[model samples]
Each structure stands twice: as C-alpha cells, then as structure tokens.
Target: MSHHRSPPSPPPPEPPESPSSVYCTPSPQSKATTPSPTARFFLSRHQSFIKPSPLTKHILPRQQSSNTLPPEFPYEHDTAKTSVGLYLRKHRRTNPAIWCSAIICLIFSILFIFIVVAILIIFLVVKPKTPVLDTSHATLNVIYFDSPGYFNGDFTFIANFSNPNKKLNVRFEHAVMQLYFEDGLIATQSIQPFSQRRKETGVVVIRFVSSLVSMSSNHARELQKQVMSNKVFYSVRGTFKVRASLGAIHFSYWLHGQCELQMSSPPSGSLMARTCKTKR
Candidate 1:
C-alpha cells in the first residue's frame, strides 16, 4: 500500500546541486589560479600584463605616467633636449679682449722697429765739414844728446810753435808729448797752459833729462843702452790754446806737428847725422 505513495516525491530530487556547491571543494588548481594582492596592485598601476606560460599571470594594457621616467630611459638623449645645452652654446660666442690685445702688441712692435731704422739712416747720411783759415810762418828745432850734457845733458826738448790760422780762436786743455826712440816710446810729458791766441808765437820748453832716462830704462832697456852707446832719434809733440777773431766771429784751433832731433856730442866734439824723420 505504501509503494504507491506518490513515488515518495523522488526525495525532492535532492534539489539539483548548485554550480557553486560543486566548485566549493578545496582544489589545488583553483587555489593556484587566484591572483595575489601584490600582483593585482601591480597590474592596476601598469594597466597591462602578459603571461608566457601557465605558471605566470600577466596583466594586459600596461600604463605609464607622462612625467615619470622608466628604469631603462636614456639619460644622454634627455639632457640634449633640455636648457643645459643652450646655456653652454651662448657663453662661447661672446668675450673678445684676448684677441684684441694680441693684435695691438703686434702693431706696436712693428712701429718700434721702423723708428730705429729711420734713426740709423739719418746718422749715415749727415756729415760735418771743416772750415779753412789763414796761415803764418813758424820754425821748430829739436835736439838729441847722448851724455845729457846739452842743455844740462838731461833729456830735454825745445818747442817753437807758431799759429798760422790767424782768423780762428783755439782753447787747449791737455798738452801731451810722446818721445820715441828707434825701438818704441821712450818718454812722455804733460803740460797745462793758461791760454794762447791765434797768430801768436809760443815757446814750450820740456825738460825730460832724469824722467826720460828713468822711463826709458824701465820700459825699453835696449833703447837706453843704444842711447848710452850711440845717439838716438827722438820726436816732440806740443798742444796749445789759440783764439782767432775774423770780423766779429771767433774760432778755435787744434795744432799738431812733428820735428826731427839732431844729436851732438860735446866732449868728443862730433855731430851725429839726423836719425829721425819728421812725421806730419
């Protein structure tokens, strides 16, 4: 009798199992498929991701900030596009004193060289001329002795100077006399005079008896020995001051001359021939 009881309503068909109920069982595959919190955050920021294999979950549509740079960005290319390059370019174009100073120095050196050359040329082209004056007559006699007996036998010289240039003025400061024997210089004498005039005949007597003997003995022993054995030729030089008045103009004169020395012996009573020729 119970078997016919509505087939027992088929136990309510156990209400067909829901899809959630079937998937509710703890499975390693389902747990592995779930994304981690870190991975989800990374996908949100990048917007895109890719997975090459089943072990990896890749987000798609990666995103980037317009102002932010990536880890692999090129720094050298970025710097060239910024303001730093423009500043360096502008600084090199201005500033010129360095070049200007070099040019100015070169010009000054050339000018200095030209000035020196011009001075040398002027000196080479100009020369001074000597003036001529009137002449007079004069005589000079120089004697040489061996025994220092003539005029006290000491080495002595007599000068008879006459100025023929009557129209000029002359001033003499230092008068030097050089005596020469056959070998070399035998004696020298210096004299100072107050003054003299043009057309004036003056006598400058120089006595070199002891001084000449001593000097010749020290420097030229051969000359002294020759003088002792034979007569020696000597020369005399004189310098004087003269002033000449031609109209209202006054001029100065310098006189130089040479004379022969004739030797004579008193004790032996023999006169030697002239050994020295006058040099003008």
Candidate 2:
C-alpha cells in the first residue's frame, strides 16, 4: 500500500451558483464568488426581495397626510422599517352634507314654530274692531245756477272719525270725500292721512266748492224742486284705507262711509238732519 500511495483528484466542480444564493452572501473583491454578467443581472433584479430581519412584524404603508389620522392617535413603532406616524387606516365614514342639511332643517322648523306661536298670541291678546264715521256739523253757504244743468255751490262740513276698540288704535290712509246730489257726483275733496288713539275721536274740516259743474236733467230738476220747498237733499261718500293695530299686531281693510244730509236752502242754510253709516 505504501509503494502504491497516490493523491485523490479534487471533488467535481460544484453546480453553478444561483443568483439568490450569491446575492445573500455578498462579499467585496472575491474572485471565486464574483458573479458573471448573467448572474449579476439576475442578482440586481432580485436584490429587493432579500431584506435584513430587523423586526418580525410587517410595517404599514406611509399615509399621505397627517390629518388622515384618527382624532385620538397614539404613535407606535414595532419594526425598525416602520415610522411612529404610520398606522392602520380607520375609515370614520361620515357624511358632512347630510349633517349640514339636518342642522338647517332643524333651525327652520324652530323659527316656523316660534312665528306661529307669536301670531296666535297676538290674535288672542288684541281683538280688532271697526272704526266709526260721523258728521258733527254741515252748512250750505251759497247755491247759484249758470244754467239748468250747470250749477255752482259752496258746502262745508266737519267729519268725525272715532275709534271704538278700547285696545286697538286706528289709522286712515288715502282718505277721499265725494259729494253727490240725487245719486250724481257733484264734487270731490282730498283729506290727509290721520291717526286716532284707542277710543279717541279725530275731526277734519272739509269744504267743497262746485265750479261750473254740470248736472244731469234728473239731478237738476230734483235740486230745483228741493230749493223751491226750502229743503235740499245731498249725499256724501268717504273712502279710506283703514289700519287697526294693537301693539305689534296689525290688520288692514277698506272702509266705505255713506251719509245723507237734509239742509235748508241758501244763505244761512244749515244741516237739518243727517243719517250716516260705515261699512267694511
């Protein structure tokens, strides 16, 4: 055996190294382990898969915004690769549009209820009543005829307006006065807007002077006949926009006043009698 001693051949060449094994055990300036061009390409492509085991737990993805975090967020870091700010996303799932709409609806409902209650209280506390119109005095100063159908006259009157409601005040707007003879319009006059306290009376002096007013045949004949008998008949109409108010409650309506007057003929002519009525 000593005379036949011979060294054994080296072991057969190892199988080609794989990229995965070569990249994991990287060493600088080592000829035997140096990767070939093909192996280098494979190593470069697979380099991202091989990572150091700094910690075992998986790291969450980084959030784009900090405000996307929870209202009560506690920072935690379980791995060296993960940051304290990165946390699992919790979708709060809220509807801001629906919440805003609900708030607006609630406010409107409260306002409507309050307004209804206030209006009801006003109606109960202040019951509105109609005002009255009456005449205190009237006189016919002159009457002259330019023709059978054309006439001139001067009339004067004091109009009395009274508020009957003890709790409601009254105001008259756009007041106008018209004089008629035998259902025919003779003259018109204007009166200023006026106000009256509760249960108070207001007076306005009105004067009408007919200047060359033409009358119908029936009206002229009736006027002539009345003048002959020393008893003249005339009518007056009043139109007003009346507002009745108590505190903050206010109601408005149109009022019509009609009066019939009997007067003695010419020059010291005075009102003998009058009948008046007011309607709403």
Best by lDDT: 2
The digit string of per-residue lDDT tens for model 1 on 1-280 reads 4555455445454556787657456589877987789988997777656524634324332334234456477685477457667876775653588778888999999999987775454345422112222112212233343443221234555555454444443445546766565535546777765344555666666655323243333335544454566555555544443343444544455555555564543233223433222111
lDDT of 2 by residue, 7-118 (tens): 9989999778887656454457676777799999998879878774645223433353333544345343234225433554435766999999999999999999988987
Q: By summed lDDT, which 10 consecutive residues of candidate 2 come out lowest?
A: 76-85
Highest TM-score: give the candidate number.
2
Clashes of 2: 0
Q: How accurate is candidate 1 locally (lDDT)?
A: 0.49
lDDT for each candidate structure: 0.49, 0.84
Q: What TM-score would each prediction reach against the true structure?
A: 0.34, 0.59
